[model samples]
Target: MTRHGKNCTAGAVYTYHEKKKDTAASGYGTQNIRLSRDAVKDFDCCCLSLQPCHDPVVTPDGYLYEREAILEYILHQKKEIARQMQAYEKQRGARREEQKELQRAAAQDHVRGFLEKEAAIVSRPLNPFTPKAASAGNGPGAVTRDSLSNATPCAVLRPSGAVVTLECVEKLIRKDMVDPVTGEKLTDRDIIVLQRGGTGFAGSGVKLQAEKSRPVMQA
Candidate 1:
């Protein structure tokens, strides 16, 4: 019988009771991984595979993963993380470019407002007949300020990439936040603290504005 208790490096930690009646359904192997009502949520699941672990291994961050699945992830997923990050940065760069154009319009609006107020001082732009109002896209400050908005979800942790699920954040917070794929350790500095939205949702705590996402390991 599989033993149920806290995790250790030596043996399988079974969180749910089972009679070894598993079929080869999940494609991992023919191991009994059926979940029982007594199983604890999140506490008994694999971090990487998000499935019940037959051969559980605990990381330094105290997260559980299936031995074979995590080992495979550690070996091959490093490149996957890199690919994901490259794609994410590419998209973010494009968004920043768009934001710059929007910022130019905003700066023009500001200048228009200023001109309205200083009608007596200068009725027109300092061209041949008007003034040369600042270009919004030309200023570094404008680019910095306008690049970020509520529409942008913080992408500081690229390991999660577009898949910013709750499980993703959980793996990020505890311990040193190891990415099994890259064997990289992420600090809080790597995270872009999110601003609260109208929905009062952000990454202030573990609970993020991100949608829900998922499971286990043994001896």
Candidate 2:
């Protein structure tokens, strides 16, 4: 009889334990004997077969997101992009309007300064009865109260042919409270103060106006 849990080294021949009346079926050259359930139960050894893990975690489809959820997410992203685009467009429009207003104010200031200068020069008290003096006062201020013929241009004025710059106009505008839309309010200050011979326009403050605009789209 071969004992269970016995460590054996065989030289040539080996034999397994034969139960009663079973040697006939275990005969011949070599026999592979399978253990009976009763014999396997009688053995005091652990026989644990490792079973393959088959816990199912099946996905809905071939993709991670379902079709409807993916569509909804895409729509939401598009809406967000559209909202951003709309906001950018509004900002661009506002900036353009500001630039146009600035340019317009600058142009108006330049024209007004030129006209004033011309008026002063034409209004100068001429030598009576001289054809040359009469011909000299033939520019834009031929018939204005503050004629250009009597006065020299302001020191800040540029040469006759050069384009008038916006820097001086901007300085003057900041020093005074003026409406940028219309040139009518250029000298709206109640009092003018002189400090070291430089004129300063004095007033309460810049006026505030409220206007309605389209609301920016939210994300």
Candidate 3:
């Protein structure tokens, strides 16, 4: 028995029935009959040793098997890493949403406080409801920087609503302790206008006629 490269064993002489007429006079007696042109020549030869074969059971250390195992391992690792990354990305997205909500809430609080003070100032009825009364005497209250010492995060009144910036507020109230506009003293009314527009009073200047009967103005 002649052993081929690796672990293959060459069996008795192989004979094809179609080629039998040509080799009939030859002394090499046939053992097994070849079925077809495509049939393997050696039955004892490990089929896994062929070029495109991938029978791990026949040749565990074949190139196909080793490479296949390595590729499979890499693919599995890629899937696992992708799953973990997906979970991490989800968690990170949730955290970002939470942070945005907190920022919005803080901004709203600053605006609310500013509006309340302005409302108190503008709500106060003058001695008379006439246009002259509105324009007379000391005139409307003006916002200054000194009054908003406790204010946090500067606020801007917009037609839609109030806008608050954390950095600006800290600078205005804590560091500079001044109003962005007027560049003068900060008053409680200024803080409110900063929070809500001056026109926001009486829900867009809707006066309460009954309040005129009161002896003293209520802010």
What TM-score number comes out for model 1?
0.23
- Lowest lDDT block of 10, candidate 1: 137-146
For each of the candidates, the C-alpha root-mean-square deviation to the true structure, in angstroms, is 37.1, 29.4, 26.7
Give lDDT: candidate 2, residue 36. 75
Give the whole-model CA lDDT for all candidates, comma-separated. 0.54, 0.42, 0.48
Model 1, 66-162: lDDT tens per residue? 9998888877888899899999999999999999999999999999999888885745422111112335532111112223334443333434322
Give lDDT tens digits, candidate 3, residues 22-133: 5665757664555785655344333434334243433455434334555676699999999999999999999999999999999999999999988888555222111112
lDDT per residue for candidate 2 within 4-48, as digits (tens), equals: 435454334345544322556656454555877655422222222
Superposition-based RMSD of candidate 3 using all C-alpha atoms, in angstroms: 26.7
lDDT-best of 1 and 2: 1
Cα shift from native, residue 21, model 2 (Å): 83
Ten-residue stretch with the least lDDT total in model 3 = 125-134
Task: Assess every candidate by TM-score.
Answer: 0.23, 0.27, 0.26
For candidate 2, report its TM-score.
0.27
Q: After superposing candidate 2 on the true structure, give the runs of residues whose Cα lies further than 4 Å from its correct spot.
A: 1-64, 122-219
Least well predicted 10-residue stretch by lDDT in candidate 2: 155-164
- Between candidates 1 and 2, the TM-score winner: 2
